[model samples]
Target chain A: MSDADFSLWVYLSRTPLLWLTVTLLAYVAADRLSAALGRHPLANPILIAVLLAAGMLAATGTPYRTYFEGAQFVHFLIGPATVALAVPLHRHRRTVWRAILPMGAALLAGSLAAMLSALLIARAFGMPETVLASLAPKSVTAGVAMGIAGSLGGDPALAAVLVILTGAIGAVTVTPLMNALRLRDYRARGFAAGLAAHGIGTARAFHVDFMAGTFAGIALALNALVSAVLAPVVLRALL
Target chain B: MRGLGGTILANLPRMIPGAALILLCQLAGEAIAHGTGWPLPGPVLGMMFLLLLLLGNDLLPEPLPTPSVTGAADGILANLSLLFIPAGVGIVGKLDVLAQYGLGLAVALVASTLIGLAVTALVFAGVARLVGRDGEAEDAA
Candidate 1:
């Protein structure tokens, strides 16, 4: 409010450190809160952090681009973290290898279902071509989904948002849905969540159990691979 | 001065090899995808590459020292969800598009996701049963 205070705000906001610190602190707080709440899927730390960061940015009138400048460091780690998924897959090699047939079948079926259902529902609603394209890869991880969306003439940014929402929705609904279906297998549960929700879902699976988390990671990678190849081809034929 | 700051600085040098290995794999993946014009993302390919490297190491006469690799990878995986927050916040920027197509998008997302999850689980369960794997029972034990 005061002139000195206003000057300080401008200087602080201009630095990359502000957003970086904010993102880290917000996520840490959300992680603790999620833990305190017993890691319920609805209390997803990423979801909470996103809300908190977005709210802070909006309240301070800081542009998303400015916030991203600092936050991109965290984003850059996704690549390395993705590569790290290989560690778990390596650990669970025998299980994955033995179930290769079932996993493959599920991947193909799930990928097609994800693409077709989105395309049909969006088409039925008479959404635009771009929106339809964006929705096609909604079940894949954000990075791969966005790429697929872009190639299919969809809005990549919208695809990213849709991917996040799908992950959140999948995380929240998976436990109840699986329980309702009497699905007790961690492999089945984790794979289903990964196929439906991608990274966030995989994270939720990990929280549930170590074996589940391992399969979820496997599913996340394979689903991304399968969907990337299938989405554009299917969209071409359908749209 | 010799406390938190020095300890972190001391650890910094040790973290580089692990971080570098990950980055190198990612770069190789990017290069391969770029060269082959594959539809896959570099990181995804990079993951496959890392898997192959690990597999290859499995057959070696003497395994390579990879403390840094495990350290870096574990550190990153431990907080993997944090990486998603940046892009997630970009949702705030797309409010207009969301406002326009919020209903359609919501319907499609929720419906397709549920369908995908259900179908995948049923199919997997069925196949596992046929194979007599009883993955659920195995996991429970």
Candidate 2:
């Protein structure tokens, strides 16, 4: 019995399953906590869940690889989820058509402005080159952001963190800022979310309405495409 | 119960391609990355390859699966909340990183989002105007 308990502890301490379970429970708790806090930007669930998980891992000294092993099942679903976005895009074909030009412009202007503004501001603050590289791809999706960051000599892992942070903050602030600006149209709202936040924004846009959600998906994919094509060319000019 | 079971059984074949296309892309992406020594992220490469395939070919496999009526596709998209679980969990592994760059990250997000929004609004507006009359013509036709 003692041997079994020892083995179980060993497994729990080293295996990814424990971390995965901890992540799930912490995520749920964070969601509840966010809701109870009236969904404040400061109480963002992703932010909280990440903090909670990180703390636990640090305390337990559990390697990230073990945790990732158990968590990858969830990661594998991302592809299907992305492909599934086509459904909403198909449904909102009219909106897409109407906004195609504006969307493209937005992506270009957005990407450039984002990269330039971040570097400018970071420079003003005397931030390091690493921070500049890390923040360059903050608005694009993780897949693209990591690539840009890596190519530019930034850390991919750091870039991933920056990307998520960008999305979470965007998700939190988009609605209120839009409302303040009196941007009532779902099309604009969704596009803004997708362009700015990537998938997280798309997910958040769905909460607003179907049109918004669909537009966000289109925006997300479009921005990714635009960024991929433009980042190298534009980034050369900036850096 | 019988109807539900029948419906599921009927749709299994159709659903396979959607899954297959994505998986195939992942595999091909991995292969291309290995072959070419491309520095692009594997999944990003996969997405690009799949996008090309989708655009270039009409010949998907035989007995073309009926495009989902609603359930399967809708079920996945609608559950995007859940879909983010893994990524979110992964984020948990990096909290110290988050804390270290919190404010700077926040500034970047806001700045980028605002720019993206302004640009999107402008581009979309211009496109809509150009396409607006054509859409009407199409409708009239």
Candidate 3:
């Protein structure tokens, strides 16, 4: 509570450096914990890091905006990292090319199922129309889903939250779900991960295996396109 | 002294070409999307642009030196999960809406995403089998 100490706190709190360090340190800790636990499905590092960051912000009464100011640097990488996916795709072109037909079929099935199942389940529960619209694109990546939701008259922020939640849920549940279903094909597993989870799921697939990661990356990109076109049409049909 | 800033800054100078290529492609993607009012994300288009470059590189008389570029890409991707934490943490700000529809939303999201994921994988696997892709080489590897 000393004047100098308080001044230092105010200064550091305003800078991107402070929260950036926190986010990294939290992730490093989470990653190590996951490794220690044999990368168990429950030990998803993003989940752990998000909880940690949220906890820190909550404890300090920091606004999400202030925390984001520091953490936007990490967010910015999603673009470059997305572009980086091309490297692996090129490296594994033959595998992807070979499975092109199956990939297309799976894309249609998965995209419709993602939107329809979410909307129907929520609607049956008597959730409102706006909620249905936003939920329709929940499985797509955040930006695209938010756009779809916005254009559909849903709350864009709510759509963004739902998209991230969908990603997190998909990331956490995918391995166990795949295992329980006895799926052994990395391509199949990865495509599903990206198809359902978007980048977060793709990140999980990459963490597990490279082949899965490659397909997941393609799935992530392709699903965005599929869902953008499908979300509006599907939502209208349902409404 | 710069904390995490040091890490990002330290990695910058040595990887200009790789960094430039990625940013340029992404920028071009944004420009195109903006110009045409495309519905697709810039990053997705950037990925396609980069893929074409990589694919086109194969047809060139001499392959380009791209170790640093790939290396830079690899480095960024290696820590890819780190990038999502920021947006993930923003969930803290949306507690009110979440609170209002917490139970239904949670069940709906979790159930639907798991269902979508499982269905996609199963369908892909089934069709791959039916298509006579024994994937012997893939399996052997």
Q: Which is the leading candidate under DockQ?
A: 1
lDDT values for all models: 0.85, 0.65, 0.85
Which CAPRI quality tier does the interface of model 1 achieve?
A: medium
The TM-scores that each candidate's chain B achieves against the reference are 0.83, 0.58, 0.86
Q: Give per-residue CA lDDT, model 3, range A1-239, as digits (tens).
A: 99999999999998999999999999988888887888787788889999999999999899998998999888788878888888888878888888998899999999999888888888888899888887888877775677778878998777877888888889889998999999989899999999999888988998888889889989988998888788878888988
* Selected candidate, larger DockQ, 2 vs 3: 3
What's chain A's TM-score in each predicted model? 0.97, 0.87, 0.93
lDDT of 1 at A152: 87
2 or 3, greater by lDDT:
3
Local error of candidate 2 at residue A193 (angstroms): 0.4
Over 4 Å off, model 2: A1-6, A25-45, B1-17, B25-72, B82-103, B122-141
Who is ahead in TM-score, 1 or 3? 1
Q: Tens digits of per-residue lDDT for model 2 on B1-141? A: 235446656886766766676666667766876688654445555655654554344355553333642345555565454445455545655567567766665665667666666555545444556656322212111
Among incorrect, acceptable, medium and high, the docking class of model 2 is acceptable
Give the better candidate number (2 or 3) by TM-score: 3
